[model samples]
Target: MTFEHAKCPLCLDQIAERSRLPDRGYQYQCPACGGPFEVSALAQRRAGKVGIHPGARAKMQQHLLDGKRPRVVFVNTTPNSYYEVREVNASEQTIIN
Candidate 1:
């Protein structure tokens, strides 16, 4: 299988995408951030250039520690924005606050 490469939105580390989760997003198990991240195409570009806020990273890390997945849509879009974290269970998906 051909692997697609991109930068982790949380850590900006060069990472290998495990799968294309439809549309223009990728799923990865990033080494730097120490977890899995679901990132959209545009979000990857933003992370590479503008970077993300420390608070945003902390949020994601917290979610991971609590056993949730971090779904990154955009980072620091307005200097106060952060990516979304998804809570997956046996049923519906939720957006963690």
Candidate 2:
């Protein structure tokens, strides 16, 4: 998948590059503010399930990194909420506020 340009909402700085750690750690940082961004596996799973438009993952990651809550909308509402993810095994699967 093609990656989208990500910008930091706090500093409006574009994410230029990323470095992966040896411990299976991945982080994206803003060059201007040095804020580390997190890309959750749940978010990736959600993107895959919906076949979201290309570059959507990058945009969402940036939003989450900028301190905004990450959410995905689902079509089924009977068994679960529109924003629910089956991949999320528990309520704590999401980041705490």
Relative to the true structure, how large is the alpha-carbon lDDT of every model?
0.60, 0.40
Stretches of candidate 1 exceeding 4 Å from the true structure: 5-7, 13-18, 75-82, 88-97
lDDT of candidate 2 over 1-97, digit per residue (tens): 1233454322445653344323322234556644444334444344445543335444545555565543333344576633331222234232221
Evaluate model 1: give its TM-score.
Answer: 0.60
TM-score of each: 0.60, 0.28
Write out the backbone clash pairs for model 2. Answer: none
**For residues 1-97, could you state the per-residue lDDT of candidate 1 as single tens digits?**
3456666656655574555655746667666666565666666566667765566677777877776777666645665865555543424332221
User: What is candidate 1's local distance difference test score?
Assistant: 0.60
